[model samples]
Target: MRTSANPIIADLRDRIQHLEGSVARHKAILPFGVPEIDAHLPGGGLAYGALHEFAGGGVGTVDGAAAALFAAGIAARTKGKVVWCLARPDLFAPALAQVGLHPDRVIYVEAIREEFVLESFEEALRFGGLGAVVGEVVRLPMKASRRLQLAAEGSGTIGLMIRRWRRPTEVGDFGHPTAAATRWRISVLPSEPLPVPGIGRARWLAELIRVKAGESADFVVGACDVQGRISLSSDTADGSGETRRSVHSG
Candidate 1:
């Protein structure tokens, strides 16, 4: 007797195999440069399919820029795919490049309106090809944040929400729901005295205000630039040393 071949069955089996491979690939998680922070987070780092928010207001612009640079460094170590969604078109490309992010690996999308910014952010997160997606938005509603969270979960990519502040209350209040895995507040620290002159070092105080896996409110992690890239500071070493090293980056 001759056997009959079913094309529908074969196609279904192929798709299932493909999906299984995808799931297996997603088991690997990306780690932020800070070990203490990563230890507090689920999966030892920022989970691939999760949304994280960076809140900034009292910190000022320098700290905000440092936060962006920090996220860029994390994305650079990834599979080399990143999308920077900004409300202003004139974002200093050179500044980002100075922080070790090659211009070629970055995609910049400029959206002037807040609504447009959030819409573009959602679209980029849904694209699924990027390793990480970052958005600088002034205000985001809980409903909208939930939608973005779902999109990130579906895409298996990291989503960074940098909340810009127009007023004092804007800094304290982020309208996101409980769905966010981690939330941070970043501010620039006063420059410490260095052995060498004319070369200034950057420092930031990152407060883990909300985290699902660990404690909530005021877990400060010191951050600084190491060889032009951002990483967590070493608690053992003094602020200024001839050689700089990152405490964690695995």
Candidate 2:
């Protein structure tokens, strides 16, 4: 025998699903799928509706590229458009695609001046229908960070700040307190030796410098697989083992 679903019951189920989705969007955390790393962050993942800062450990191009890849991976996980505000003319589209963030999903903005960068970030964060807003700037004051945080909260978007300074001394400026929910420093690390003679995927010393409700910590982990996934070295997941491994799986 075949029976059709009741219209009233079907309507109620749809309503329930909508409510559940609303709750998740308002209070969900995006997991990075690494238990050891998630243990150091509140809610076991990166919180939405807030600002996160990622900075290179040095002035070298490799350092900045590492940070950018990390930030891009985060954006790739989100569900909508991403606005990338930077002045760099050499952003190889292939490199971004390597981390799972395709060019079609990104809206790149070239802001030559620091002031314009801030403005663009704020604008993107305020606008609706964005997954994230990323900005590359040397200076991010407490006030500017607060604005970004509030805007993201209002729009339910994530904000990423990539700090790259011209002078070595200027790098110190990024260590100061800001309204960002979390801050990270990415440093390039040597990769594990491969069975074949070839350069492996990027490895990094990812330092969680600040978190809203967690202590700072560091981990050497593989980042941004072809699928835009990050994972902790299985040996080091418990915080007691060490092993050199490529950022991407073979």
Candidate 3:
């Protein structure tokens, strides 16, 4: 009998290695820092080197803006420059700052076509030193999504996909698989009713529609604190004085 050829021992070694790799991938996460939300995620945060998707509930509604801000706030938590591969010129820098993504740290790539946007996003994700990468697209095909996921894995950059649809019906396409680690849907909620009659901080219905690991969930959260950190609201009711400055940000 050969010395190192025992099938049982070899199988055990392979299984251990697979488990270790899976743990490593899930452990490198940037947490929301909110206990309520963190408890839902398997690793207590958003996974680095993985793609996450977010979209508005519908078109014509301002909820799309809310979704974009949520993604931006997550991106802001990254350490280096953020690559925003967008198709439009209408992104408001000041509004982004309100959610924690600063103007100076953003590297915007204005792509006129959806394909261009995806290409730019994948390229940026493959770049070794970036903090994060965000791309705007109405629909993300499975093939392109797989490539983006691989690029993020290779570079260790967090990827955020913000969906923007010209037609309201296209929002349904977001449910299709895209190899993303997590999927979120953001809808604008009425601001908190203050003690007085004035407007309170913005609130949002944040839904975790899909998760690669752990159970999916939802939250009625206020808004991001500075530097892209989220502060969750316990009740869906009144106000909390969070998500300051821009209502679109929440």
lDDT of each: 0.68, 0.81, 0.82
What are the models' TM-scores? 0.75, 0.82, 0.84
RMSD for each model, in Å, please?
6.3, 9.4, 6.2
Task: Name the candidate that leads on TM-score.
Answer: 3
| Maximum-lDDT candidate | 3
- Point out where model 1 deviates above 4 Å: 1-27, 57-59, 175-178, 196-200, 217-229, 234-250
* Clash count, candidate 1: 0
| lDDT value, candidate 1, whole model | 0.68
Query: Which of the predicted structures, 1 or 3, would earn the higher lDDT when compared with the native?
Result: 3
Candidate 3 ranges with C-alpha deviation above 4 Å? 1-27, 237-250
Ranking by lDDT: 3, 2, 1
| Candidate 3 lDDT | 0.82
The superposed Cα distance between candidate 3 and the true structure at residue 125, in angstroms, equals: 0.4
**What lDDT tens digits, residue by residue, belong to model 2 across residues 98-132?**
98899999999997788899999999988957878
